[model samples]
Target: MKHPKVINLVQEPEVFYRIQNKYDRIISVLGGSMQVGQVVNSDIDLIDITRRGLPKSVVITVSLILGISMEKMSSLLHVSHRTIQRKGDDELLNVYSTEQILEIAEVISRGIEVLGTLENFTKWLHSDVRALNYSKPLDYLDTSFGTKLVKDILGRIEHGVYS
Candidate 1:
C-alpha cells in the first residue's frame, strides 16, 4: 500500500502553531486526541477531526488559512457576525456549516498540494483569473456553488490546464 503524504507541522512552525491552537480549541469543546504538532497525513485526517461538529475557532483558523476576514467567513457560512459571536468557543456549528468547513478544508489541502505551499495557494485564490471570468477565486467561496467552481478550477490547475 502507498504511504500517505505527511505534512510535518514542525517544519512550518507558524502554520503548525495556528493549527495547534485551533486543535486545542476544538478538543476543548468536543474532546479528542490532545496531541499537537503531528503530521496531517491526508485530507481524511481533517475530515475525521470534524466528524461531529467544528468549534467556532475553526472559522478563525480557516480565515487565517484563506487570508479572509471573519466578516467574509460569516458571509461564506451564511451566518450573521453576531450569530458567530454568540456561538462562543464551546458551541458546535450546525450540520450545513460543518459541511462547508469540511469542504473548505478539502480545498485548502488540495490547493496546497497543487501549488506547493499555502502562501502560493492563497495568492492564487486572491488573484483575479480570466478563466473564472476575471474574478478572484476567493469571491466564489461565499456559497456551495461558488466553492464547487473554485474546486473545479483547482482541479484543472492540478491537471496542468490553464484554469
Candidate 2:
C-alpha cells in the first residue's frame, strides 16, 4: 500500500505540537499558531519548502529527534562538519541539503505511523537490521539511494512483510 503524503507540520497545529515535543526548535521555525485565515485545503507545498531551503535549526531539530548526532547529520547531507557547525541557527541550508532534510522528515513521519512513536522509530533507525545486511538503518541515510532503500524497508514493515 502507498503511504499518504506527509502532513505539513507548519500548517497543522496538532501535528506540529506533537512533533515539537520531540523537536523543540520546530515551534520557532513553524510558528506557534496557524496563521490567521490560513486554509488547509491542500497538501503542503513540498517544492516551495525545498526552494526556500530549510533553516539550519530544522536540521538540528531533526537530528535530535532522530537521536542522531550533528556529525551524522553532516555526513548525511554530505556537508562538512565544520560547515554545518558554522551556520547560524536561522541560516538556510542549500537546496540539495534542504531537500534531503525534508525527505528524512517525511520518512520519520511515515515511520511513526508504522512504529507507533518517535522513540521507537529512532531506536529502529539506530539498531542493526537483518534486512539491511545487519547494518543499522542510519548507515544508509547518507545518500539518496540509501534513503530510498531505508524507506522501502519501512514500507515493507508497515505492510507486515518480514524483512
Candidate 3:
C-alpha cells in the first residue's frame, strides 16, 4: 500500500496567501489607478498578467514608494542599473524580473499596512533592524527567501512581538 505525501502548510505561505490579497489593490498600487477592464480577482488572474511581463513603470513606482533610488531598486531586483535606466517606463521586463517586482510590491503593501504609515514602513525598511542582526530590511529584498524573512518580521511587528 502507498501513502500520500504530507506537506507543512506554514512552509507554503505563497499558496496560503493566494486568496488573501485583492490583486486589484496590487494593480492599483503598481499602476497608480484602477483602469477600466483591468480587474484582477485571484492569483490565477495575476499570474496570467504577470507571465506576460509587467511594464518598467512598475519598478519606478515601487522604487518611489519605498523611498529608494533607481540604482538601489536595480540592486534589489538583481538587475543592473544601466539596464533599468536604458528602458523606457512603458517597456516590459522579462517574466523573471516581473515576478521579483511583484514580490517586492507585496512586501511593501504588507509593510505599510502593518507598520501604520508608508513613511514609517519606508523608514523601517532602510533602518537596521536589531532582530535581523542589525541589518536593514532593504538588504533582503534581493531574493525571495530574504523577502519572506522580511514579511515574517512584518508579521511579528504587527503582533507587537517587539522584534
Best by TM-score: 3
Tens-digit lDDT string for candidate 2 (1-163): 4422233443452453354232222222233213111222223545666676777877776777677789988998999989999999878889899778766765776667668766687899999998999999888877778888988999999889997
Model 3, range 118-139, lDDT digits (tens) per residue? 6788899999999899999988
Superior by TM-score: candidate 2 or candidate 3: 3
Task: Report residue 58 deviation for candidate 2 (angstroms).
Answer: 0.5
Candidates' lDDT values, in order? 0.65, 0.67, 0.72
Reference-based TM-score, model 2: 0.75
lDDT of 3 at 137: 95
lDDT of candidate 1 over 37-156, digit per residue (tens)? 223345565565556667786677677777888889898888998899888775778767877876675566666657777778889998999888899988887667877888888889
Backbone clashes, candidate 1: 0
Q: Is candidate 1 or candidate 3 better by lDDT?
A: 3
Off by over 4 Å in 1: 1-51
65 in model 3: Cα distance from truth in Å? 0.6
- Clashing residue pairs in candidate 3 (N, C-alpha, C atoms within 3 angstroms): none
On the 0 to 100 scale, the lDDT of residue 128 in model 3 is 94
